[model samples]
Target: MKNQTKMWLLIIISIFSSLIIFIAASFIMGDFGNKGYDIGDLKTISNEVLTTIDQQEKGISSILDAAHAEHPAVHFEWIQADGTAIYNTAGTPQNYDFQQLADHFLSIPYNLWTEGETISLVYKTHLQQQPYYLLMKLPSTAMQPGQVYFFLRTTKVLLTLLLPLIIAFMVPYLLAIWFFSRMNRRIHKLNHALTQVNLQKDIIVLQDTSKDEIGQLTQHYNSMVERIQSQVIEIEQFDNKRKQLLSNLSHDLRTPLTMILGYAETIRNGLYKDDRELQSSAKIILQRSRYMDKLLDQLLDITRQNTHALTLQLAPHNISEMLRKILADYLLFLDGQDYIVDVHIEDTDIMIHIDVALMERAIRNIIDNALRYGKEGHYLGIILKEQQNDVWITIKDKGPGIASAEQERIFERFYRVHQGRQGDGLGIGLSIVQEIVDLHQASIHVTSVPYEETLFQIRLPKKEDELN
Candidate 1:
């Protein structure tokens, strides 16, 4: 059930429970006070009072006088069977109708009855074994001869005792009701806020100021929304890139295919004048064909990487040795470039698990990029640092460094910082490098200052046993 419903239900039960307890206590105390006088109890008190009065030497008259002196509010008359008043209190009327009072008592359910707006108590007793009736007039029916009755016209006494009882039971009950109501209202407000929130516009927030469990829930929900928003933005960006990629791929492929088709058609039509011209046409066709093949291969590699279908042959190998071997091929290529090479390797040997072939490709791709764009700076440096359980390989070059904004995007498929620069290969070299690095559970990032220097850092984790 809803919290509000449960809270109201609990409050109702508490009030009813308290009321039941109060009524039950009243009944119990009433019985304990002996106010609900049974016939046996009334007979006992009447017998004692009558015996004392009969033993007096002056008879009922002196006894009545003495009782009147002691209790001025008490009034009674001792009536004989013949309706003659043997003894009457001073306040008794001279023509008091005893027959009417006796008849009135017989008609009522209880011995106590009201007479003309006055209330009194009646008891049947015997003086000297002769049957008589003791008729007592009282200020209030509540002030009986031997017991106090709480349920009569005892307003002052009942109010005096009931005021404190009401406060003792009602104060806490009211406070509890207020507390639950306040909580229910706050929760309802929170629920309304949650329902009205629009994630497409902005994150949902609770206006509640208290640092309670609900507040914590709001914080966690906000965090989850933020993560979802970021992922949505990233997916949208990737979608845009994919659209552009298809357009670029078609353009790049069509250029080379058109050239190859034109030259082959010319050769087939024998449009060339001599063998030399024919050979030139054939060589151009072969070069374009090779370029297309290379582009297609890069495309395949990227597709496989994205689909998690790229396989790796994982084995422990010395990372320092791997770097040296990959650089050997680049050293051969840089022979006529007149570039200065600064190579740094820590003396310690570090063994890390990696896919050797893929890692070499990633390294070669980065160095090739450096040599291609950084030729003007004429300085290439390789640094390898072996730490406790990790390896750091940094390649630095003095080149027209990449802009900060383009650093991250350069790793996208077919993305090139300087598209105008002459190049023989597809623009997926860096993208492939990123794919391979990620496959080996490694991280790679680049930082550069324009026209100054660019540093590409790659961190690889080593196995725990190897570190030990």
Candidate 2:
């Protein structure tokens, strides 16, 4: 669920980033386009104004001829066309080049431009909108003929360009907002799922079962939840077994000790004084006392592992040298027995952090278990291998392999896998081996295949941190 939320967030942010780039670029391009059109309109209107004025030449001639015929001696003339002007409402001629003024005026509808020498304010309502300027050339006989003609207008050009620019701004802006909202909705849904996950509560099953990438991700998350549920169930089962084993321990050993204590009190303090009676009572007392001592010792070693009395002093030491010394110590005790001990080890530098005495006791118990439970003529084998960062030790034998159902409980205290072969000592040897390995955080595994081999393997990490 957390993963899904992160994916949706990334997608949403990417879409928003693209939308911002698209809108910015579109705005710039639209403005540039409008600017180009405005420049063209100015130039085209300049040419049209010139045409309007040139068509007036014949009219100007008719008016000038009538004035000259009426007053024959009046002197008047028009010559070299320099420029023009148009007057505002304030009766001032618009200043600048004649062509520029003509372009500015010609853009207005129903407006006319003509070359003239006089400045005057003219109102023409025939234009679609009242223009900023309207210019006309005076007759050749008019006053101030020294001035050329010019005109100016701005209203029509602005209205022509305004509508399209507004459309350009709105269309893509609306679409970008629409796309961003869509991606935001997807991300919000995914975030809700992750909120449930962070609280360590049950997940809400997403109902959007569409066949897209989101659907695939939802399916994977559901599978992870199922696997986690199964592991939790396994842990509960182990906890229940641990409780059952503790209950069994109290029942099994207390019953035998009660009888042994009762009988010992009867013989002590002159209760059995005859020679034959004394001898038999002494033997019974000695045997029962030894049995009780062994049971108490086994329980005490594991239960108070941190007590100063039981805790072994740990030090750094070479593992190969220690194992060789342990092997020599075991050899003299098994001199007469036909059982063979095969040791396979590498001649490499493998050092470890451990209590030498406790380690020796742990390995001896494993060897004893093999010898006591193995089938006819099967020898015990110990193989040790080391890599740069770890060591693996394997103990194998052709024992009557433990049943599949008993493999897990076989490591519990007093769990006897083979009932017929359980007479030598309490069934806590493998338990001790497991406890020691657990104390060091090393790993242990057991596997038994029918009629082939039974193996106990231990894996220990390489000692890397030096004692400081």
Candidate 3:
């Protein structure tokens, strides 16, 4: 059910349960409740007093006096059948102001006015030998017979019956209200937290102190914030990288373009009289053009990688054979150069799912990086290992290893490790490699120590069923 629906359902159930409990407890306790001056009991007492007066032939005053002593809150008056006053306890009039009594009687609704100031009865049987009317006058307190009458008569029984019914109805109702009130406060807190979120600043995570639906909502909100924060950071980094790439492109192109322009102008303006000088100028111009073309190609590669337009041709293939061939190609390219290639493979037929061309390009970048930067060490090692449900390719070099602080930025486009290094290529090979690896759902990590050794490890997932 929806949370709001469930909340209301529970509240309704609590109220219904409280009502049921109140009714059930009241019925169960009724027998034990106070029987305070029941109308029937009062009538029986009055008949007994009348009998006593008839048998003794004593005046009605004596019997009324005794009844009055027994219940001080009540008084008695007798009136003859002919409307003559026989006896009155007050010794004056009936002591109840007729106008005031009539007004009080009229003020109350007829259905609600059960017992009032006077309870009168007429005696016409032979036991009295004459017709008479007995009028009972009750105190102001007993004039209204309600719960208070029972309390004034018997406290214990009345309390026992009332306490449980009152508690049953009120306690659950109050608790349900309290629970919903707490939920309301938490919802408001969540709303405030959401309203206050600012993208320009770090994300704020709301506190989820409860183990309820509200807490779950807060947790999901926090997770969404974390994902957005990560995307924002990635976008900012890409923006910074783009700015740096343009700056480097401008600086790198300036020298070569200047050389090409100056030499061409010299040849065009006939500034070089000697044939040899003219040939030299043309060769320099040609060389600068080639360098510029190569720089443009690298820039294109970076653009393609950053824009995520590289399509992958995924297939299952032997990774070990692929590595060996890649190494062989590198060896041929760097033939006779001061370099060494060492290879290790645990299995020659270990198959993996990959985009062959992209994976090859990724591995080629690592090897090219080793050959270029590790020229001083003159040694490179490639290790391929198959583990349970996974495979790893590690390339190690013993050149002037990267500094600890620069390792994290090594994969950034156009990021040069040594700013003063002699180079004609843009620093985007590793970045492209990282992009391809990410496309394959793979992970790469690098460990390097200055002047010691650098290791780059790439991990890829493998399934035994696919291999079989």
Candidate 4:
């Protein structure tokens, strides 16, 4: 996968990991929460029932006392142990049969009726219709979970156990996510900008004003970018210097090779062979030798320009006037050439700051290449055009356009595409032009449509743009 895609995957995984930890912790702690204290409705109802039981026991005693004191004639009743009537206040024979009463009394448990202890019941038969109060022995058995009285409340305990754990885990997990979510988005924006930076495209810098770890990271990232830009500038300068040295050396070597070839070809063809012809050949040989010396000198000058501090002999001069004068000097050598030349500058006298001699050599090398290679009647022209704020001095040729794959390499030294021809070139002209353009802070771009049009478009800052 690409570096960009891998970075996004890491960021997404971080968020999910935080969420997963929260869920697992919540599940483990949920079992221990205490909710039973809040479900107290059953205790309230049991207390009210106990109060009713106490009132019923007291009312039973009041009725028993009334039967013994005043209802003696109405077949008054009395309870006794061992199946006997201890007292009958009524004159009539026993109203409740003793055998039937003792059996009925033994059936009702004593715990259901009284709190502590109970005496025998005293009630007349007419007054005892409201209740059959039991006079019996109490059993001492206790109640527990399995018996009918026990119903453990599980619902109340469960609710009390789970709520706070849900809250305890949820708040921190959400807080962590909310905190990181904003930082994550900013990092994503910065990642996009950094990827675009490698493509030589413009980037929008990330803005994070928060005082946090993410903010510090952004600041460091920006500082790293600044350092990288400085390093790139230094590396490019060294590269250009290296290419320049090779180009000059190759260009210098070409003259002697050209002479050597010309002499060998002339001797083979058996051209006129007098002492003057011999002298002419010798003269050409000597001239090429000296040309090598001048090439070395030019190479030294380029090295000086790059290594030492630059001292521009800045002056305001018209670009068109200078080009015309340089073209006039080249008229003798180019008089018989078949190439077409056109000049269409917007201003004849727009003064700008430049080193005039250096600028002329850069422009002249371009025209010289055109004359040498405008073979088989191909046309070459120079046009100067302007748009908005900049002026372009474009030199175009309809000769074989430089191939799409070879355009970038053209500015490198000693890199000859049209190989094995020494008089033709050593590939220094374009390299020199590129260096001068860099020094001037102007831009150069070469674009070509194969089998159609090839252009070397040089954009120069206008008079107003040049500040010395």
Best by lDDT: 3
* Residue runs of model 4 more than 4 Å from their true location after superposition: 1-272, 308-310, 345-348, 373-378, 386-388, 413-428, 450-452, 465-468
lDDT of 3 at 266: 90
The lDDT of each candidate is 0.73, 0.59, 0.75, 0.58
Model 2: ten consecutive residues of lowest lDDT? 117-126
The regions of model 2 sitting more than 4 angstroms off are: 1-231, 265-355, 375-399, 403-468
TM-score of each: 0.61, 0.44, 0.57, 0.43
lDDT of 3 by residue, 203-277 (tens): 778888677888999998899888989999988887886787777778788988999999998989999979999
Let me know the TM-score candidate 3 reaches against the reference structure. 0.57
Candidate 4 or 3, higher lDDT: 3
On the 0 to 100 scale, the lDDT of residue 314 in model 3 is 74
lDDT of 2 by residue, 144-187 (tens): 21222224377777766767866775676567666657655665
Ranking by lDDT: 3, 1, 2, 4
Q: List the residue pairs that clash in candidate 2.
A: 83-149, 84-148, 84-149, 84-150, 85-149, 85-150, 86-150, 104-153, 115-137, 116-137
